[model samples]
Target: MTCQELYIPKSLANLKYLVELNLSYNELEGEIPADGVFSNITIQYLVGNKELCGARSLALICTCLCIIIFIYWRCTKPTSLIPGTPSMKEYCAISYYELVRATQNFSESNLLGTGGFSSVFKGELSNGTFVAVKVLNLNSEEALKTFDSECMVLGMMWHRNLVKVISACSNLDFKAIVLQFMPNGNLERWIHSSTTPYLNLVQRLKVVLDVVLGLEYLHHHHHQVVLHCDIKPSNVLLDEEMNAHLSDLGII
Candidate 1:
């Protein structure tokens, strides 16, 4: 189930007989009440609510109170105080510090590839799930525009042959998009690697079909038109079973 503006009712805290509560993968907003049902909730039970915040153990950043004080101190305009965070409507908002630790300071060993405006690094979360982290270069204005574009497109589209967006992190100096790791690497590696066997005619057809289906979904399935301006072997990723998935949508 999907909801546009779902707020966990405060009356839920009054249910003393309720022993367990599980509300995940829904568009929930507002502060999570800390009275009863929320008093002992953990990350597993509360994850996927991208806009939730409270005194919960989950690292839901509660910066509203702090931002209010800062605005008062500066005597600035009072507009809607939206955090400079990744659009949490689709994916979890991760911290830059967590990403740094996950990639081990983005060591060379974990470096996947460098693109025009960003670099991809392989990272493993605390739960041991691997992810591809695209770190954007904040110094470039063009790069920031590209990052915002990618977030807008990827946040709305989902398909079997498209790379899964796990989470994202964005602050003043840091910005990164977290994605599910493709184990078999990109199509370029498989075709160029000397040790790897050549892809047979059947396997080659499958890869092409995957790409076509992914592009079809982007153009026909979405409400708005999306153009994937960049498409190449290096941008086409493969899974452990050699299934193809498109990646690198910054220019899409």
Candidate 2:
């Protein structure tokens, strides 16, 4: 029979001998009890209940529950602090599954750029926060070393002219760093693209000043002197207001 109820009745699970159920083409909108008939019924029997989840439905309630729990842990759990670094409470812990969802399985359309050892993709987190995901290519030893260097350096540093490290995901098979999203892209594009608006003398000077300040902080202000061996227009990212920030500290 057609069940137009908002939820599948939990009492239905108590029917021990009930062998068949056809709750198809209903307005049901909640979890389906897994006991009794639900366990035996095919997905066809529950067709058209778009909001229905759990048991034989296409979306399972258990999966949603797990995501909720995962998000809670990521937000509430205390991260290990680096020796000379500020509190890492601002960084949210992320998972490979979340990153996959954010970037649509790292689709080519989301690719921001690619480097010799890694590729960057634009992603939007569940909370609607935009971020850049830099996925490392683990086929070579140097790539692995670069990942380590970036994590070690960025984790301890914070500056307005430096790209902020949001978090990182690391496992045996996969490694990625999540960073602040730069909307205006890199200086190389703005300087080289004929179609892009030309940078005036003042704007050009501001970008140069930003890069110099960032370098000064890294080389002199930090507790330990750090040097960025590679500096180029491509590594200078522009944010929404055309503010410049230095990025790609992997080779430092």
Candidate 3:
């Protein structure tokens, strides 16, 4: 259901026991408040499209005792952030079954790119959410180690500068990671694409700054120390807004 204002309807009151309210793909606008009698509601998804003004929940040591901060944090800014993280939990993640459907059983057409360690594919899952899936061979001990290390490290962190893990999927035969989709593809592709506008020196500099900032964040800031051992131009991706996203750090 979609709600877009100060005075939400009383009809919604009937859904008092609803667990997952997905109002993500909507044009909901205005401030999000904790007022009203339905204040008990949780897991309210107002993402995808909206001009939401406020939220309430977490605290600081960054704490406002007068108000609770919104834990449903979404990044709306265009400025690229950098976090040099050695772990993978800092991002979102998707389930294994979800990946199977998204990639049509890992078909070749969905293949976006590939590397020695894994192959990347374009995917739109059962929930109609677009994403990028990276698959590693199930038999390789090295790949297993990389995936486990990433999950342990990345599962615990979250930031705009870091590439979000949608979820992880595994089977006796293989394993994979689901990540937020990047329509613009990666920086390496754009840097050489004949159909795209070339990034000049200033643009390159800015991108480099973005990458550096991300690395710095990973190294510092986060709850635990992170080190992005794997760093290069290809590991950097750009989204629709030209924001940078780092991917495929095999660091343990």
Candidate 4:
């Protein structure tokens, strides 16, 4: 049996007297838990999981940031969920395992869209909060750059006309940015899909105005003049109220 993306859960380390664990020839990601049976497992047992690492000599040395993020998740479990909350760093520090579970292991049914280097999936958190998880393909350097840029920029800015980034998740095999899911979808669908009476002139103007306002904030109100290299119908999302909000700032 081959698993595309396997996360060695923390609970597996609890197994006692389970010797001779052989996990070779399987695709695995994230840190190898350095407790319980895993501590004694040899490199031969974990071969081919290039993304797996920890205190084990066979694995790569985990960065301080990754370790810190893991520790935070291990210690803290939020009791409630609220919109516009200020737990940016904490909320963003999520595990690939959590995202997989949230999105039903990235089932095709939850897939929203796919770009040049990533696929967006609809996810629901344990607290019933919805999010759009943009999972990037790490094999592409451009995708990595986009992920980094989006995270840095989104962390620093906020505007009603602009899409909101709620949190982020990163691991050896998985990297994603969690965003506020737009219920109405993007402007492209309304414009191209065979929907009822096309957007009236007033609605069209409102969408244009929303895009202009979002761009204005990024270019003028922000500390720096941010440029969105790509602005198209698909990138302009609409909320439940049909209010347009500019999204996909990865290339900005």
lDDT tens digits by residue: candidate 3, 1-252: 435353334565466565444555566555444544335433235444345444422211123222223211122233343446434534445567667787997899999998877899999977788988888876677777788777676666556656787777767776887778888787877776788787854456557656766775676665667777678777898877677767776564
In model 4, the runs with Cα more than 4 Å from the true position are 1-92
lDDT of 4 by residue, 42-99 (tens): 5557778777765673443333345457545533533222345343564556678878
Top-TM-score structure, candidate number:
2
Residues 1-252, candidate 2: write the lDDT tens digits: 445558988999899888888988976888888788777665557778788865456443454465568556543544322344553445679999999999999999999999988899999999999999999999978888777767877877877788989999999999999999999999999999998998975577678867877887787777678887779999999999999999986445
- The TM-score obtained by model 3 is 0.60
In angstroms, give how far residue 216 of model 3 lies from its true place: 1.0
Q: What is the per-residue lDDT of model 1 for residues 136-214, given as tens digits with 9 covering 90 to 100?
A: 8888789888777777777766677888778878888888989889988999988999978788645776798778777
In the predicted model 2, the residue pairs found to clash are: none
Identify the runs in model 1 with alpha carbons over 4 angstroms from their true place.
Answer: 1-87, 250-252
TM-scores vs. true structure, each candidate: 0.63, 0.65, 0.60, 0.63
Q: What is the clash count of model 4?
A: 0
Considering only N, C-alpha and C atoms within 3 Å, which residue pairs clash in candidate 4? none
Ranking by TM-score: 2, 1, 4, 3
Give the candidate number with the greatest lDDT: 2
For model 3, what is the error of residue 46's alpha carbon versus the real structure, in angstroms, after optimal superposition? 49
Q: What lDDT does the true structure give each of the candidates?
A: 0.77, 0.81, 0.65, 0.77
